[model samples]
Target: MTQAAMPQVLIVDDDRAMRASLVALLEAAGWRVEAVSRASRVAETLVTFAADVILSDVRMPGMSGLDLLATLQEAFNPPVVLISAHGDIPMAVKAIQDGAYSFVEKPCEPRRLLTILRHAADQHRMRRDTASLRRRLTQISGLDRMLLGQTPGIADLREQVLDVADSDAAVLLVGETGTGKERVARALHDLGRNPAGPFLALNCATLQPAVFEAEFFGVEGGQVGKLLAAEGGTLFLDEIGACPLPVQSKLLRVIEDKQVTPLGATRPVPLSFRVVSATNEDPDAAQSDGRLRPDFLFRVNTFVLALPTLRQRRADLALLMTHFLEEFASVYETVVPELTQDDMAALLAHDWPGNVRELRNVAERRILSARRGGGSVAAAMHKDHELDDVPDTLREAVAAFERELIGKAIRAHAGRMDAVAEALGIGRRTLNEKIVKLGLDKGALL
Candidate 1:
């Protein structure tokens, strides 16, 4: 362990000689020690040296050791041992009641004092470790479970989320399609300041220009707007860039003012809720194209959290695949199929344009197919390829068409790469590489 990791004790005594003696004794006893001549100075000393245990003289000038113990109890949880010549049975009992870990009489035996300090330090270390473990457990079962991955991008993203989750700031989630933007949005809400409060989600893309205002702001009827309904909680607006231009301006006003007015009402209702908005479009391009309002974008993007693409975090692919397989296997009550080397190679080579959502769907399909008696992960992946959105450009169209042909040929040839290659008029090596590149797994071909 480093020097900082060593057991540390802060000694507070008004007697100059006693302070020096105690410091020397503790240092000799294999403990890092800092001695202060006053109880008031203990707090300042603690700023630099975080003592695991505080050993202080009960009688001090300004703040008594008891007073320091009281203050430290509220600020931090380090164990405090109080010692004084005036220590009586009643005073010791009262000190313990006031949260001192232990009380010792002065003219104390060095061996016994060291023993008490050792116990105090150990107790403090245990308490700190337990608190840290509890926090890790909370993250594992809650937020980390939802956003599962070991990639640096994902780890950084989790750190960022935890940092801002407790604040009342508006957050913007930027990502590509199927990158779990909504999951991230929900995480921001559930892990936020008001987990128990309402979490209202609205898709701006589905909103029509005519009814968008009335629906969002609420009419003169009994219906309350999302802003009002999400009081003390969160309102997640997905596809925020797709919101009509005029409504975006009004949304910005509501956010900035922390109030909102219904379409038919004259009075503005006080609004209070964290706005967590998401968009797949590039903010700069959207703003330049006039699809997203600049002022509205800036207002919502107080903390812009850019999510990593599936391609960017390919290292987490196997972990995510296993997670999805286990989840879907339990749902379908089937044995999880083990992926062959070829199948894994195919998975690694494929350009996962659809991201995690696509991977999850493939896993579900594989599980369902397994329950039906016989199917391959490769086949499920082939299905995913076919189900991909229509290609927009000539290059993509050609690639998609070529991938489909190769998939059909492999299935027809019964997993024989040689026959498939011969049938396609391509070399065996070319066929193998293409199969891997296309994510058409060997099991599916077989």
Candidate 2:
């Protein structure tokens, strides 16, 4: 492995000699090590070093190792092994209960310590990946108010996605069409333990049962199926509710056995992959209608995430409007049109029955028409309908749009100040100053 790829460890001890000794032990094992003589800087160290495993002495000045563990848990909690003395067994037990990965006794055995460190390092890698994906989810969807907004529903969904991304559990994402269910599945895959592994996605609705056996289970001629293609990664089955009952049985068997039997072949091929499925319809209704098997449903959605429709998350429409405006304008090489107060009200009040996809199309149309100097977006949106009494001035409307625009840019880039600043065409210092002045929340990224 390259030097950068090597596992990085952080050692915390007040005693210089002990700290140096621990650092040598880890470095000798081909691991990169950073040793500190204080627990107060543990948080700073984790961020700066991006350490894979933290080996800290339980007895320390200021905050104890246990206290550091608690503090870190509130943030990006790593796998911490408290190096406790012989008499600190009770304290070690309490530390483990409080969410420390494991504890090692002092006068540590080199072999035992290395074993613990390796395990901790592996877990640390998993958490690191999931955490990165969690951040990217915000960044990629930053302008996407429904998924990356400050609304309670979006906040709840973000938490659920982060919580389940690292696990091997089967996930079922349920939502209306255009609600970005596939995006959630991809996040789970990207944030999974084996992110480097191949991610294979298939639409169950497009599966033709007659040839699906070959498509899913592979042919006897040595063609690999979707199941095998996703080995060591994730297989996302979208619109799973549309799958035929016969296919559902086979899917259940594959999931249960964690193996696949290719067509015209008897012996099964053992495989390792995570399953994340999604549907636009209600799962219970599908089950009742015999479109989905109860056993299959139970096996697939061990962790279910229900996505809200665009109408439910209407608070983000204006932001999404502005975002899509920038999006299509750049695509078609047209200028982004301004949204008057009447336009904003009409867009917000109109229930987007078609959800995000419909809104996107609407934005594209608006941008195209405005490019040809045809008409305003508001006129087109409210062509057949009556306009609401929107009393806000042009300045107020511009300020509101700008706020959401900045907030979305902040979130979409995972709160990386440099990237956010670059995207906004501003300097880092100016962005920080603006955030303070505008009262924008930067905590979500951190």
Candidate 3:
């Protein structure tokens, strides 16, 4: 079947008759119409209906149409043409600055209004399309993939990523566990010039303390260490603060001399890789504790990228949710689940200690579980054992249960960190830290 090409316009007015008349006129002009008499309900209506233009009366009871226009400007950019019975040119000009697309006097010139609506719709379509393209480009740039956030803190981090990616400066990514330090490291490698070169990653914490030196400096059998393996590429050392004191000295030598001497071998292997290290611990504290050498810290700290906790970027929940939904849908071969405003509200309300990684897990689980007839993501989320019963007197137990519930939700959402964060009423970054602290395996969510 051929889809209709009519553009949709939402008419908001206090008068039912006026709204009906305007709808009729617009429909006659080969446009699709949705009319809402109450300004208070326009926000909810817009959430469900896709519209090209909005025709709103400037004055209305309860909440003025102007107020609605202001709210819509932040959520979505739709061309809004204000209609005023008592038209004031100055007020209209002010409304334009406040984001109204245009203003028209009421008392009905059907032809003129249609012409204006068409023009406004065209302009809105162009702007929306452009914004969509920019979002796609941002995603393609792998900026969105670094971590989910639209806050100023996140914006600053993104700028740092771009700046540091342009050079070969060694970077130290500082953040709490589960804050996606490794993801940021990968983003740097992907955005850098030698992306095609080997992108090697190793978690310093995963290596046994006894074998730290042998593992990092390579062993005798001619086995190359992670640093040497990433020659002409990127070497990402996660939990760098976890490296043993003795190994720290060896790493410092490699960074200063640009070479690595394998254990039980005299000759040093030339290092030609860009190093990006991550740590959940404070660099200065680690140095004072003798867990990290100050010289090594200075060498790797040529650039520093500190990831913000999820709570700091709550405004980005919707954007991150949308991005993760699309990602999980492709992975599971299912259509993306539609999220209601309440769902989004719940997500924005919670404090996520887990960060972006936790959000991804939750989204993936929700998609898969919902597809299998489990129920809504929010409902399925509550079924986890951790959220099932509350135990009194054990604050630590309660905290642990909360973490478990958050983790289960992430798993059920299929690794969509934003969706899981929303379902659990927590911030994505907060949830990330909790996941790390609780040692939740995101692989379960996938």
Ordered from best to worst lDDT, the candidate numbers read: 1, 2, 3
Model 3 superposed RMSD (Cα): 15.2
**Stretch of 10 with least lDDT, candidate 2:** 382-391
User: Which lDDT tens digits does candidate 1 get at residues 241-346?
Assistant: 7888877877788788888778789988888889999999888899999899888988888899999998999877766776787788888777876655455666
Clash-forming residue pairs, model 2: 139-412, 142-412
Off by over 4 Å in 1: 1-140, 388-446
Candidate 3, residue 18: lDDT:
88
Which structure among the candidates has the greatest lDDT? 1
Over 328-385, each residue of candidate 2 has an lDDT whose tens digit, in order, gives 8889897767665456667877877777777877788788667645556665565334
lDDT of 3 at 151: 81
Task: Tell me the TM-score of model 1.
Answer: 0.56
